[model samples]
Target: MKFTRRASANWKGTGMEGTGTVSTQSTVLNQTQYSFKTRFADGVGTNPEELIGAAHAGCFTMQFSFLLNEAGFTADNIDTEAKVNFEDGSIVSINLDLTATIPNISDEQFQTIAAAAKEKCPISRLFKTEITLTAKLA
Candidate 1:
């Protein structure tokens, strides 16, 4: 791979009571706090699922934009949200919600492009689980 992004985590103590901080090479999440509370409860920090959701959303949106460009369409706006559903200590599914504003595009075309983007996004491909998408054109 030509691109290599990196992140690291540090923890002190047991999983339940332990506190940890995650850092990325870009320092966007420099020593960001994460713990059991953050992952499974109402804690004031980031969680793994949340990060996964963000990555999926970012990747999917970019892929959608590129697909649109290839289809000879330019979107005025493209909004996407990814919800990673964690169950039984595994990621069972993911739901991608998208709203886009593009000119001169039919619903059939939009749906095809949306589905393509969802499937082609690297994060979506990385997960071995059901992925659903809801795309709205405006």
Candidate 2:
């Protein structure tokens, strides 16, 4: 199956002095500039790349929880953080750190399930960059 999202951007002037528009609509748009990405904290909003990282992290954590449940284990908490590294304007890697509280599971079993989740998550398969996962069981 295939899925796609439509996005468009329009930039005016130079990279430092210019601003842009991002839209799903044909005409009306949202404004953006270099400050939108670098100088500003993204709590207001962000571009697709940042949004993708957020989606990947959250989706993977939820997927891991489901996998654990299928193995007869339940998790108290699963916190995942994903770091996206850009080198020379290219996406270099995505690092995922997952902290989970799983009651009554052996360390070995936890490792096995964690590995399964990392490899089996759909988002992991969608990316070409390196994906690193650190799973801590507490």
Candidate 3:
């Protein structure tokens, strides 16, 4: 049970003025553009932190769904948002905001499963920074 993914980046010129394109194995983002402005300022291109957030959110939601099914419940909908905070060129923390709708499930049960998912998800374990989760049943 092992899997690996790959992404590559090519940059030119100085940090402030350089530009680059990032490509992933899935090609969901094929040679996507990114630059200093995109990373440090409000630019038109995607950044690493944004991509990380997307990955984290996707992973957590899927893991939560698995947990719910194992608990004999099915989730009607699960929405998760991951906020990756980068400060001083380092990742400081990640905040996961989750809202879910599951029939016949108590808030306590839902919270318990969500907390377990947050602790056991693969992406959650990859981060060394503090990971916080806020889960709500809808």
- What lDDT would candidate 1 get against the real structure? 0.95
Candidate 2 structure quality by residue, lDDT tens digits, 29-93:
34543334442334444555665687789888888998899999999888999888777767789
Question: What shift in Å separates residue 12 of candidate 1 from its native position after superposition?
Answer: 0.8
Q: Would you list the rank order by TM-score, best first?
A: 1, 3, 2
lDDT for each candidate structure? 0.95, 0.76, 0.95
Residue 45's lDDT within candidate 2 is 41
Clash pairs of candidate 2?
none
Report the C-alpha lDDT of model 3 over 25-128, residue by residue, as the tens digit.
99999989999999988988889999999999999999999999999999999999999999988999999999988999999999999999999899999999
Superposed model 2: Cα runs more than 4 Å off: 1-14, 20-36, 39-44
- RMSD of candidate 1 to the true fold? 0.9
Query: For model 1, how many clashes?
Result: 0
User: Estimated TM-score per prediction?
Assistant: 0.97, 0.73, 0.97
**Residue 4, candidate 1: how far off, in angstroms?**
0.8
